[model samples]
Target: MRAASEILAVWHAFDDFPMETLTKAWHYRSGNEPKQRSVELMRLHRERYGSSGNCFDLALWLIDAFRREGISAYAVGHDLLTPNAHVAVAALDGRGRAYLCDLGDQWIEPILIDAGSGDFTEEPLAGFVSGARVALSVRDSWLHVVYLRPNGKRSEQTYDLRPIAPDALLAAGEYSQRLLRKPLVERRIYTETEVLHWELGDDASYLSGKRGRTEEEPMRSLADRVERIHRHTGMDRQVIEQALTVYGTASIQFD
Candidate 1:
């Protein structure tokens, strides 16, 4: 297994990276290029315009980072039957111990899961600790995750531990970005430190911090909306501009 320190370092590096869900409509309208490799995705993130993608893109990027550091890492995802099929990174340390490293979910650090470990709950990530519990369990050969909210609420997801080849992972991401009906994408939901929801032809709603304090701002011009989103998300201004442009022209509607 790799050193825990190394895993923690990688987690810190990307802990605050923005996570965005762009609809296929936005993707096609922006004329954005298709994703094929982790390196390509990283380059897009580093560009003057920032990059935003689904969980697959985020997980692949983290897996790539671990590989670059000589740690054994792979992309893991659940099958379609799961409630919210998701992707994350499974990294093996030098000692062959595996840990779950999830950046797309904004985890504070890597979670340790011993082989055949049964269900359990752990404290929230460092910066996000609010007496909430992150529970992990194995069921139906898939990793089940539940984020227990402080208010007795729970958000759930699952990931298949079977390692997905890089090529296959890329294909899956492309397919999701192209053909999948992603409600988050449809609603133009994006979150980093806060949750942002914006729908075409409607006012934008922003939930600042974990307290869920929400504020609604009237939709000004598309340019104004882009600026507002960039300000709150700290995403690349250019990327937000392009995405908003696509949002406007695509005439995307919510279900």
Candidate 2:
């Protein structure tokens, strides 16, 4: 089994990586089409102009980073046919034990996946101070991850354990950008920070931040949304303006 100390180290290194806004215009503008190459995405992340992407972007970067550190890792996903599909990284420690490291999902620590049994629940690194509990159970060939907060609230995500190939993952990325009815794709500008979620839509702009604070404002014009994103995310002003000009002009409905 991978030592708890080692897993904790990797978890802390990537825990705070920002999950930025992704728009269809920005997706195609990266190149002729959505490019799923981790190297290119990582390069963009290093460049201030390239910090924004969806879950696949985040998972791909994590896979590359883990491999560079000599950890055996691969990209995994579930619900490929649905709009709610999600991606994450699976890492194998020195002792051949597998763990789930999902920065995009904002998991505080790596979760241990027990393969032999259909049910399991445990703290990531027992004796390490953390307020989250991870529980795994298998049903109908789907692995469910239940993340429980110290206050008794819980969030659950499920995925297939089968490893996803790079080409397949790339294709999935394209489908999600084009065909998936996701809020990320529908919103003119969507962003999630550590404690906030901002989405600009046709009718109204929604803002939700820490401590259950949520408010709505009249929809701002495309230009205004771009400026708001620029001011809020610290992304390049020119890049945001260009993307909004090219992609944000479409008429989209809000929920």
Candidate 3:
């Protein structure tokens, strides 16, 4: 339990780090290596742009951090064929208990996946998500998660706990970086009572929590949107402008 708690503590530190593609969109530099970016590059991006890449990038960052802290962590994922596939870290504690650490989808914190852990319980865990309760069950080698959200809506995902080969992971990361969708971002902001998701996307932006959701005021112009994104995300003005400009051009091309 102590080991899992330590992993959880590391996961909590990233609540403020956004999982977005803007930084990579603008600061891209092609190379021979696979798309798993170095933590140093991510640091430079955060310092200069205040934004980061998608799930693959975030997973890489977290795994590297765990290793530096002397923790045994590895990358895992599912939906390997989809561009929208997910990636996350499976960190093992001193006793080899594995905890699922997901920051890309921006989970509130890490959760214990090993049912064999000392403190593992059957009760659904709340607070890890807003407006929902998370239930974990392990079948064979996979950890299955079910989110019971409002209106009886049930969402499910399974993590293939088997460790991914570094080369394969990097190849997938490279493939993921090639694709960019709408100019968007999602971040988690937690309060004493609930977790709030701040989302900015193609059509509308809003803040959603357990109680309700509030729409963000629309930006008046391109420059206005850049300023607002910077204010809300603390990304550098220059970086935001450059990245958004690429998306704007892509929109024009597609249109």
Candidate 4:
């Protein structure tokens, strides 16, 4: 079991790691590389790029990280067999509570997923998805999350709280590691007023926050886009360059 404060200490460190966009390309040697690398590699790429992998990668990394500290941890996911599947980590805080640590979604901090605990709060928690007051609840074997945005709109999702087996987690991770859709990169920027989400891809990019979303023109030159991505994501220039080269450019998207 782990302590919430202990998990926070670990997450405080991981909070600096960016959610990477180039893992799939790096694994396939699709970028400006010579040959395909091992598809199962995660740690090497994390350090090589100075960031963490996507959702699955982040979950797996956190699980191992908690274990290294002698804490119990596991992976939980929903829609695992679908293209929209998402995964996150669940670590037991020895006190019989579990915290939902979702760095992939750029959560500012982990939130208590155990609603039965005396410390649980129904008040919406901010930063679980950045710029939103995320309300969490556990009932009927499911964890429900509601995102209250600054704008007059809200979105909801249900997370199956059951811990998934290691083999299933690995299988889903490998499948995701091999699937390359676009050169997508994400980063959460903190400011005195609010948190802004920067979402970038080969075809499109945007900075979203309390005021509103500002869509940037599609970057035509690969060099320019790579530089811009680096400025936002803190990924190495060479890595971003290679990833864009493999992903190529696409028509600008409006959505």
Question: Which stretches of candidate 2 lie above 4 Å from their native place?
Answer: 1-3, 7-11, 21-24, 115-134, 139-141, 147-155, 179-224, 244-247, 251-255
Pairs with steric clashes in candidate 1: 1-93, 1-94, 1-95, 1-96, 2-93, 2-94, 77-160, 78-160
Task: Tell me the spans in candidate 1 whose CA falls farther than 4 Å from its real position.
Answer: 1-3, 22-27, 30-38, 80-85, 115-131, 179-203, 208-221, 251-255
**Candidate 1 lDDT, 145-187, residue by residue in tens:** 6776646686877778888887777777666555333323212
Q: Over the full model, what C-alpha lDDT does candidate 4 score relative to the true structure?
A: 0.73
Ranking by TM-score: 3, 4, 1, 2
Per-model lDDT: 0.58, 0.57, 0.76, 0.73
Query: What's every prediction's RMSD, in angstroms?
Result: 5.4, 6.0, 2.9, 4.4
Angstrom error at residue 207, model 2? 8.3
Task: Give the clash total for candidate 2.
Answer: 0
- On TM-score, the leading prediction is 3
lDDT (Cα, tens digit) per residue for candidate 2, span 122-192: 43332111334466775654677665555567677787767889888878766655541322311122235
In order of appearance, the predictions have TM-scores of 0.73, 0.67, 0.87, 0.85
Ranked candidates (lDDT, high to low)? 3, 4, 1, 2
Tens-place lDDT digits, model 4, residues 1-255:
123788887777776666765855655554433122232345676567764568887787788888888778888869885667788888888676888888777777778888787788777866566667887777877888898887868898888999999878877776676666776777777788776888886577888786667898777777778778878767778877776666664344211
Give the better candidate number (2 or 3) by TM-score.
3
Model 3 ranges with Cα > 4 A deviation = 1-3, 29-36, 251-255
> Could you tell me the lDDT of residue 228 within candidate 2?
60
Lowest-sum lDDT 10-residue window in model 4: 31-40
